[model samples]
Target: MATETFLASFGLVGLRLIERHGIDPAHFARELGIPSTALPDARTRLPSALLDSAFEKAARCIPDPAFALGAAECWHPSHLGTLGYAWLSSGSLRTALKRMARYTKTLGQRMSSRCVETPEGLQFIYDHGRGDTLTGWVMADFGLSLIVSLCRTNDGTDLAPALVTLRRPTPATIRPYEDFFGGPVRFGETHDGLLLSWQVADRPLPTSNRELATTCDAILASELATLQNDDLESRCRAHLLHELTSGEPSDTRLAESLGLSTRTLQRKLAALGLSYRGLLEKTRYELALRYLDDPKKSVTEITFLLGFSEQSAFTRAFKRWNGKAPSDYRQSPGS
Candidate 1:
C-alpha cells in the first residue's frame, strides 16, 4: 500500500546520464539533497521523490530529453551487474519480461509490467498507478532501455520495435522520443505501452545464466516477502486518501511522514495481500457511499473530493459498485 514509487528504477540511469553529459554526478546528487556517494548504489530502492527530482534534473541537463533512453541502449551487462546480467541471460524476451515483472521491486516496486500478444507483435505495458513527473519519465525510459537491452543480449538489432507509445502528451522533451525510438513514436495515449514484433519475442537469447537468474529471483523474492508482511498497508491507505483529495502526493514524502523505509512499507503491503490500487479503490468507494448519503454534498463536490477525472466516470463506477445510480441511491427512502 505504500505509494507506488514508479520512478525509483531510473536512479542509476539518471546518475549515468549526469556523468555522460559532463556534469558532476556527485554535484547533481548534492543538488538533489542526496549524498553524492550514493550514486553507485542508486540502483537500490530509493524514495520516489528523490528519484523523480534526480531524473528531472538529468533530463534538463542532457542535450536530448531521451538521453537516458539512448544511454540505456548501450549499457553493458556489467553496468547492471547481477540483475541486469541475469535478465540478459534469460531464454526469450517473454521470460525476461516475466523476470523483470517479478523482481521489479528491486528497481521500483510501484510499477508492474504486463505482456500481451497482438497480431502486430508483443506488447509490454508498463503500468504505473502513482508517482510524479520524474517517476513517469523513468518508467518510460526504463521500458525503452529494457527492450534495447533485450535486443543486444540476443545480438540482433533487427528485433527493435516499430513504435513506442507513451501516455504523456508531447512536451518540450518530445525530441528524445523520436531519437530513441528511431521509429514511429506516439504520445497522448491512454497508457504506456511498447510495441514489438512477435518474431523478436520468438527469438532466443544467446546467454542463459541459470545461476544468475536464480540468485536474482531469490533476492527479489526475499524482498517481496518482507514487504508483504509489514504494517505500511494502513499508512499507504491514508496517504492515498490524502492524494485523492490534493491531486499531488509524493511517495517519498509519504514514507518519510510515516517514519518508515519505502521498501519496508512496500513489503508490508504485499504481505497484507493488498496493493496501492486496491487501497485507493477501497478508499474511493467508502467516500462515494458516504457522500451519496449526505444530501448537503453536491455531486461535483463528491467527484472532486474522490479525485475522479470526471463526474460521468464517477457516476458509472458508483453504479457498477452499488447497483444503483448515485442520484437514485441518495433519493431512496427507508422510512
Candidate 2:
C-alpha cells in the first residue's frame, strides 16, 4: 500500500513562506516533528499528514486566508528537483504541463493531475484525491497559483489561464484569486483546474532549450522509476517516451543514458524475459496511437516523431500492430 506523501522540498518551500510571514521556521518544523536537517535535503520524503497539519496550523496562525498562495513566488527550479528544470527548458507550455502531469506523482504521492484537450483549450486539472479540509484547500490554492507563476516565468508574457475552476465554494472574497490568476475564476464547480487557450499553451517559449529539456526529462523518468520501485523496465519505457521525439535511440545510447553498458542492459532485460527491440517496438506503438489521436499531426510528422526513417516504415509497423493501416485505424467506427 502506498502511503500519501509529498517531496520534502515542497515542505521546505511552505516553511519558508511561513517564516516570511513572521512564523519561526524551526518552531514550525519542530511542532510537525520534522527534523531540522531534513529541510535541507530535496530528496527527503515528508508525510502528507504532517504537511496537512502544517497547512492547518498555518491557516490558524496566519491572518491571511490566501497565505499558501505565496508559494507561487517562492518556487525555484531546484524546488521540484529535476522536473523543475525540465519544465524550465520545455519547448512550450503544453509540453511543460504534460511533463508535470506525468511526473506529479513523484512530487506528491496523491497528486492526481491530467491535461485534457477541449474545444476552448487545454484543461489542466489537479485533484489531490483527499477529502475536503483546510489542507486540501491550501494545496489547491498553491497548486493553481504555482502553475500560473511557472507559466509566467518561462513564457515572459504574464500568461493567464483562460479560466479557473474550483470545487470549493465561493470564498468570502474572490479578488485575491482573480488578482493572482489574472483572469476570471469560477468557484463551486465540479472540478479544480485551469483552462489555457491553445494559443498560449502551444506557443514556443523564449526559454525553450531542446537539449536541456531532453536531459532533464530523462533524469525525471529515471527518478520516477526509482519512486515506483526501481523497475528497470519502467525506467526504460519512460526514457524512451522522452527520447522518441529526437529519434529512435540505439541500444548503446539508451544504455549509456541509464548508466549501464549495452551488454549489462541486454542481460538484465533477458533475465526478465524482455528484449531491447521488443521494448522499443512497444514504446513506438504506444506513442503512435497517442499521436494519431491528435488530428493536428500529419502522418509524416508522426513518422518523424516516432523516430521512423520514412512513412512507409511507420505504416508497415502500424499495420503489424493493428490489422489495418494507421489512417484506417483512425477513421474506423469508434476511433
lDDT of 2 by residue, 288-335 (tens): 755665667789999999998899999999999867899997675323
Q: Which is the leading candidate under lDDT?
A: 2
TM-score of each: 0.59, 0.72
RMSD of each: 16.1, 8.9
Residue pairs with backbone overlap in model 2: none
Instruction: Evaluate model 2: give its TM-score.
Output: 0.72
Q: Runs in model 2 with CA error above 4 Å?
A: 37-39, 230-335
Q: Write the per-residue lDDT of candidate 1 for residues 127-221, one digit (tens) a residue.
A: 65444465576557765666565665554464556677877657676666665566787877766777777666656566654455555655554
Top candidate (TM-score): 2
Weakest lDDT window of 10 consecutive positions for candidate 1: 36-45
Q: Which stretches of candidate 1 lie over 4 Å from their true place?
A: 1-10, 38-44, 60-63, 73-82, 128-135, 171-176, 231-335
